[model samples]
Target: MIPVTRELVTGIKLTNYKDFIVEHLEDCPKEDKLSRLKHIWSMPKFGQLPKKPTKLKLLEHTRAYLLYLVSTTIFVDASQRSTLISYLQLLRDLDEAGKYAWGAVALAFLYRSLSKVADRESHFSGLATLL
Candidate 1:
């Protein structure tokens, strides 16, 4: 199995994530201009799920929820206002999503973030619960 990294979670390529966002959410307004990662979605947009959602809508809602969960918790960055669209590629097929080692990925991301904090006196933004 490939080692998990912040950018390569469960085989979802960074380029694909960028492509997905550019194709889908490029028009969406971004609040953080200093963020290194591009193509992020506003957190508030995915804050709630539809009350009466269709099949497709339900899938989208679940995806949004998972995105929020991971971004804010495990893979969080300094820009808390938006979420990385990279994880959306993995959420595209929920059934297959379970096959990925999510816990390992989260651990990897946390380690990576911690390393950044240790290397520099930067603010910690990932998995504070685990610390």
Candidate 2:
């Protein structure tokens, strides 16, 4: 087995962002988080859900939106947050597959952006290897 380095763990940490979103799903008000998530999701794509995102898509969207909120409304200096914002925008504009890909890419970008604050070497490493 490949040794689990901090580099590997960073990707794992990025996934935690999804969990964070799920945990805070109530932050957005649209009946509930799942409803808002489905709405945000279906806006860009019209098809069956992906196996990975079927249940988790809303939480992920919540996570992405939170990232936007923090990067813009808070004191965090996230230069790369725009990549995530752009990814979300693309999700709103692009077709289904493209939106899905952008969703994944948005998380990767947000992770890289956050790593700039907490861990630099690990952030870029995560971006190069994870996404």
Score residue 125 of candidate 1 by CA lDDT: 73
Candidate 2 per-residue C-alpha lDDT over 32-120 given as tens digits, one digit per residue, 9 for 90 to 100: 32222333443333234346664456554544554444334321333332322222322232233222333343355557666774754
Query: Clashes in model 1: which pairs?
Result: none
- Give candidate 2's error at residue 12 in angstroms: 12
C-alpha lDDT of candidate 2 relative to the true structure? 0.36
| Tens digit of per-residue lDDT, candidate 1, span 10-65 | 54446444446444333334433422233244445545666886776566567767
Q: How many backbone clashes does candidate 2 have?
A: 0
Model 1 regions more than 4 Å off: 1-8, 12-44
For model 1, give the RMSD to the true fold: 5.4
- Name the weakest run of 10 consecutive residues (lDDT summed) in model 1: 30-39
Global lDDT of each candidate = 0.60, 0.36
Best by lDDT: 1
